[model samples]
Target: MTGRFITLEGGDGAGKTTQAALLTDWLEASGRTVVRTREPGGTDLGQRIREMVLHERGHVAPRAEALLYAADRAHHVETVVRPALERGEVVLQDRYIDSSVAYQGVARGLGADRIRSVSEWAADGLAPDLTVLLDLDVTVGRARVAAARGDTFDRLESEAAAFHETVRGAFLDAAAAEPARFLVVDASAPAEDVQRAVRTAVGALVGIPAPDPSAS
Candidate 1:
């Protein structure tokens, strides 16, 4: 069997990057071939798309932005993600279709069905066997991101509070829709606590023993 694909989704500063790295380290130590990557990045084309989507000061129409993301996703899946999974490696990603479903579809008011259809086409039938959602309050999450960035902001950082709330709500709704496929962790918890919860959840879902705590 191919190794499992696990994608982590969350709002800004919800610790998706930190947690994904932690999990990757633990999984590797436990003897799994892990292919770690992030969407809107990973591949060169994807990185370019990422820059346009996040760093560009120029406003893009919501539908156009959605298409850019879908295009980037298509290239990423075909060139990097698929091959890794086929080689029996567990592919861990920081973001995936869920981001689009929330950002462009819900928060940007682009229509969920249309976004889903485009993303489904881009994904080419690949879906995460399991998804880990790091749920943090919008206010707290924004603060964390702001703190890390030394008071600087990206294009997304300039978005209104209402937009962030919509994104968070969309993610929670997506989690609710796929209860069996998701594990939602309270991201406001301490890092060690977050690691513990993730370790427990992953072990349970994959039928694998938890990594040695000390190693983790």
Candidate 2:
């Protein structure tokens, strides 16, 4: 039996990690095997790449950054995601091809088509069965990120406001283009509300009731 692939995407501080954890907990409670993972740092090698792309203090050329992300994705899918799916498990992932398209392709001035093409080739064209887009205003997102990070922004997070706005638009455009694969949630809502929406959407995929919020 094939498994489900689900991804969470949004600007920084969109509460993806929290929602992913809640979903994983509820799914496991429901008797399903779940593989919770993320791009950039999902594997050992990916951790190193994540450091370079996100934490390193130097400017990486936009194309180089995109290629690094694609490299991590290629290895992540082949080694981690594919094996989990082949085992008939739910792969709950944080970020995927769309992040590359938005951050590197559109926001960085590279063509989205070009970056998406490269990313698709890297992952052998594996697409998520469901992609939850946590839509949030860039300004609000940045403020949340700053509060959580104590003003310590990562390389991408340190980008100008206009860059983040571009990234937000790109994500929305992508969701609009592929509504069948996307569930857009207003992330500005309370955290529990957003998670409830995510669980409702994901439960429909796995044939489970959205677990009670108090239980989660």
Candidate 3:
């Protein structure tokens, strides 16, 4: 009995990390084994690759950046995500192929299909059973990120507002294209409200009841 795969995605400051933590705790309290991890840093190799892609001293070409991400995805899936799922543990991932498609493909003008193909090949066609998309205005998302990490802009975070706007559109388009696999939530809401929505959506996948406020 293989376990389910759940992914959380959104632009920066969409509260994915917070929601992921909450969801993991809920699943664990429900007696399900959960493996919570994130992309570009899930493994030792991935951590090195992450630094190169997001914090290297010099510029990396758009295609090079995409391939680097693909490399990390390949290793991460084989080493961390797949083994956990094969052991029948729920795999809760933060960011995945969707991030590459939006950031590299649509935002960088590198072609979404092309980026998708590379990522699919890297992960050997693995995909999440459900992707929770936290949607919010680009400006609000950026402001949240800035406040959280003052004077520290990552490679992707430092991009112009217009670039993030394009990335946000790409995320919405992806969600629209695959309604069955995606649960889009308005991230402008308060954190607790957003976590409630996330719990409701993920509970269905794991055959658990809706979150109990008292338990939380």
Candidate 4:
């Protein structure tokens, strides 16, 4: 069986981790082997890169940050993602190129096209078969992050409200541009609702039946 690549994209506190776990559970129950991973930490090198890019206290130049992400992507795709997919497993990723394009490209004023090009090159033109974009209000996302993390925030999460709004808009624009590859869902809804929407989209793509809504 050929493998499938599916990615979850959204702002922080958008319940991506939660949804990923739920999706993994559903896929496993259906007798599919799944490889659950996330960008910038999917591999050993990626873990170090994740720390430097996300948790570093000092400032990192815009271009430098983008390159760092690309480097991580290159290594991650070459190592973790590709190998899992080759084994005919579902590679359910938490975030991918869209996160870079949204955060470093538009929000950082580095130009979306350039960032995307760099990312494409880094990942060797690998794109997810389905990218589930969990759309949420920026303000609400920030509030959720605050409640979860308290006063501590990562470099990206520490960004201003306006930055996050720009990121959200960029994600929407990208989804609009590639409607077929994206399944946009309202993430402000309950977690179960979002999971159901995700499962429906993913099931259709993978030729599996989505759980009956009435069952939940």
Residue-wise C-alpha lDDT for candidate 1, range 2-72, written one tens digit per residue: 77889999888899889988988888877888999998888999999889988888888898899999999
Task: Provide the lDDT at 160 for model 1.
Answer: 89
Tens digit per residue, CA lDDT, model 4, 162-214: 99889999999999999999999999999999888999999998778987996
lDDT against true structure, model 2: 0.93
Q: How far in Å is the alpha carbon of 16 misplaced in model 1?
A: 0.9
Give the clashing residue pairs of candidate 4, or none. none
**How well does each candidate superpose onto the true structure, as a TM-score?**
0.95, 0.96, 0.97, 0.98
Candidate 2 residue lDDT tens string, 85-156: 999999999999999999999999899999999999999989999999999999998999988878899999
- Listed per candidate, the RMSD to the true structure in angstroms reads 1.7, 1.5, 1.3, 1.0
Candidate 1, run of 10 with poorest lDDT: 207-216
Model 2 segments more than 4 A misplaced: 211-216
TM-score of 3: 0.97
Off by over 4 Å in 4: none
**Which one wins on lDDT?**
2
Error of 2 at 56 (Å): 0.8
Q: On a 0 to 100 scale, what is the lDDT of residue 39 in model 3? A: 91
Ranking by lDDT: 2, 3, 4, 1
Give the per-residue Cα lDDT of candidate 1 at 117: 90
Clash count, predicted structure 4: 0
